[model samples]
Target: MKPAELRNLGIGAVLVALAAIFPLVNDGYWLSIATTAMMYIALSTSWSLFSGPTHLIALSTAAFFGIGGYLVGTGMSDYDTSFWSMAILAPLVATAVALLIGLATLRLSGVYFVIFTLGLAEMIRNLVSWVQNNFLGSRGLYVLTDFTEAHIYWMLLGVSVVVFLFGWWINRSRLGFALKIIGNDEEVARHVGINTAWSKVILFMSTGFFAALIGAIVAPRYSYIEPNVVFSPQLSFLVVIMALLGGTHRLWGPLVGVIPFTLAWEAISVSFPNSTTLFLGLSFLIIVYVLPDGFTGLLEKFTRRAAK
Candidate 1:
């Protein structure tokens, strides 16, 4: 590995080590806040892994996430299956769904792709609700488990670590090079012999897998999961905003964005619960108008000036 990569890895390790100490030192509301932050950290990072390189603006995260939550909910509540078993199966199911979606939709680009992805969660949510109401005789399922907030936090942190490492590896691999080329120009990438569609599908599947895994991990926290709650469209927008706010160019950028944003969001949810949607919209506007390149981009500018 290059010196820069090694340095990044070392910094990431230290940050993870410090984060691990949070639960040990604090079990109050802050611990819960930290856990939520870690969840977004994982989600935004995983989202960036594909969207950053491909510039696809996928809005289907909630679909995969809800799938995982519903799987765990149904497995534990209806089938009497173990939480771990559901957790294990969730990603596989999500990956399969992603493959199907990717194959069908990856060819579309620009606003059309974005529109399809945005609609996917709503479509899936309505379908799930219908299935539950008509066939299952319920609007939701219970996911009772002994896992506490701390356990969930740790699990999310572990997933975040793995994702970061995986992203780091991808950044240095031939696949990453292909993605960069594709992002630059898909036509050029095709002309140059890159299988752009397959490359995108692979990354899309990865994002789906991680999102599902995370949803499964957090299912117990919800306890009673309804399709509407699990498949909330707000979650998708939040992940996209967080990833973009941090600057998706770097593997660690999303983490930088997630921490501050999560804390602010928590405060907003507590202080002005009814106005969150308004605030979320405002935040996106600010990100687009003022910090289009994100905090990482701003930092790079400062670094360049200092160097000069």
Candidate 2:
């Protein structure tokens, strides 16, 4: 297998191990942390498709993921949408929405794109509020009245697997090559006749799909969905921090980030009780400023040098 293929397989193995082991080692506290981490993995991995590969740092990833949460939430409560069906449909719907977002904003790159996506997230959040207030007659929606944490765990695991595999697939394909080019230089990529617009659309759409899939799972897990939780500025920050801190495009980066960050978050919350968010903020800031490629990138570099 090529290096990318090997990397992908290694990641898959790690995820499988995590899924199998989490239930055994995880209590309510740990399980909650693990599921949140998995959600981060899904969100971050997808964002990496655009931000890491295409160098199009989209800030609106939260919008797509939040939309996913609402998608399955509304489907379940108001529309009688089955969990299984929304599980299948949320990603697709999110992708379609992302396609429009990508196209409308494809002309921008780097920080510009990032800002645009931020605006998009805000817009979506407001839209969610309006819809809920007018249609649902509330500011949030809820799902499961009663369900097992294990069910949430399994569903999160399965969706995380899907997103991880999708990232692996894209990282090895023609589109991936196109994205690498876009990452390096959009002008050069355009000169090379790559359909920059289409690639952008596809990248956003792909990421949006997984983001939404995670959302579907998220709504059910909480049995509630609120605009802020779904589309919060903090949501975007968390995923971006995870991706950037974990080596962005590397196969194991998301998992690396999700695992440690989740653990730290839980630990800090338990120990400090009152300063959990403060702890996460400080950790991410330190990680970004000191080791932007994340711990996984450092590990990968050491591994490669050792191999040499």
Candidate 3:
């Protein structure tokens, strides 16, 4: 590896080590906040792994995430299945769904793709709600578990670490190069012999898998799972905003955006619960207008200027 790559790896290791100490040293509100941050870190990072290179703004995160949560909820509540089994099955189910969705929708690009993905979560939520009401005669499931907040935090943190490592590997691999080419120009990528469709589908599946796994791991925290709550469209928007704010061009960029945005969002949710959506809208606008490339992009510019 180059010197810069080695330095980045060292920095990542240090940051992960520091994050691992949060649950050990804290509890209650702060630990919960850290856990939420970890969740976004994983979500946004995995999100960028696909969206960053493809430049396809997908808003189907909540769809896959809800699938995982609902699976775990149904398994534990209805089938008396173990948490581990549900968790394992969640990602597989999500991957399969992503394959179907990607095959159907990856051909579309720009705003058409964005609109379709945004609608996907709502469609899935309504479908799940209908099934529950008609067949099960229930609207929600209770996820009772012995796992504590700390356990959730650790699991989220572990997922974040894995995502970052995997992203790093992808960024250095040929697939990543192909993705960049696709993002630059699909026609050019095709001319160069890149299998654009499968490349995109593969990355999209990865995002779905991680999102679902995280959803499964965090299901017990809700205790009561409903389609609307688990499949909130807000989750999709938040992931997009967080990834964009971090500047998805670099693997570690989402972490930069997730930390501060998550903290500020927590405050906003508590202090102004009624206007959280308004604030979310405003935040997205600000990020787009002021920091289109995100904090990482700004930092890169500053670094280059300083070097000169």
Candidate 4:
């Protein structure tokens, strides 16, 4: 294989080993931080899968994630379902919702898609909130599971690995090529016999499914979740910012983006508490102005200079 391909394979193998080994060695604070970081990595990477290739800025992460959490919450509380089944059911449920939304909105281009996705997430949030207030007495949902922190860490790690591999596969596949063409110009892609609509729908559904899966796994980790927390638009925005700030074009960019930002975020949250969001927002603005291509682009520039 070529040197670059070999390097990527080596790196992937190392990452997989590290993820598998982490939970075994650490259990307290470090495990919690690592688990949260892994969750963000999965989330950002999943967002990048479709957004990077298609140039469609999606804002529906919370919609699917919140839905999955609620599904698991209700299923366990009301119907006596198991965590194992909820994992499968959550993604399936999100995929179905994604398919309908994708079919309706994927045909629209540019800002319209973004607006629809953003609006859809908010709409769902409000609907769920209303349901909680009237029918469920505004008590919100409590996710109960017997899984330990190690189990949760492993689950999130597994999802992160799958998301990474899926991103790598897409980067090398026919779908990737079509997406590149679509990203450049959807009309041109369609004229060239690529089914852009269906391609986009597939991407949408895949992202929705995995985002939901992450939510399902993460929900039980949290003691309680209301619509405001689970369906927060800020969650959608955070992943988008993480992916963009990391560089969305490359498969590894989001993962790179998640690590440093997550660490920094944790530090800032501890130090300033109330100022965490303020600092994060400011940093994002700086990143947009200074590192348009993100840290990956910065790394590439340095590597080329070193080669020279």
After superposing candidate 4, which stretches have Cα over 4 Å from the reference?
1-7, 136-140
What's the TM-score of each model vs. the native? 0.97, 0.87, 0.97, 0.94
Evaluated at residue 274, the lDDT of candidate 1 is 97
What's the number of clashes in each of the models? 0, 1, 0, 0
Worst 10 residues of 3 by lDDT: 107-116
Residue-level lDDT for 215 in candidate 4: 90
Give the poorly placed runs of model 2, Cα more than 4 Å off: 2-11, 14-18, 25-27, 135-140, 145-147, 271-281, 300-308
Greater lDDT among 1 and 4 belongs to 1
- Model 4: per-residue Cα lDDT at residue 45: 93
lDDT of each: 0.91, 0.76, 0.91, 0.86
Report how far residue 261 has shifted in candidate 3, in Å: 0.7
In the order shown, the candidates' Cα RMSDs to the true structure are: 1.1, 2.8, 1.1, 1.8
**Regions more than 4 Å wrong, model 3:** none
The alpha-carbon deviation from the true structure for residue 159 of candidate 2, after best TM-score superposition, in angstroms, is 1.9
**For residues 138-185, what per-residue lDDT tens digits would candidate 1 score against the true structure?**
555898888888999999999999998889889889999999999999
lDDT for each residue of candidate 3 in 1-308, tens digit (9 for 90 to 100):
99998998898889888888878898888999988888999999999999998889989899999999999999888789999999999999999999988988886666776787888989998998888888888655899999999999889989998998899888889999999999999999999999999999999999999999999999999999988889998999999999999999988889899989999899988999999989998988999899999999999999999999
User: Residue by residue across 87-148, what tens digits does model 4's lDDT show?
Assistant: 78999999999999888888876677888888777899888778767886637566777888
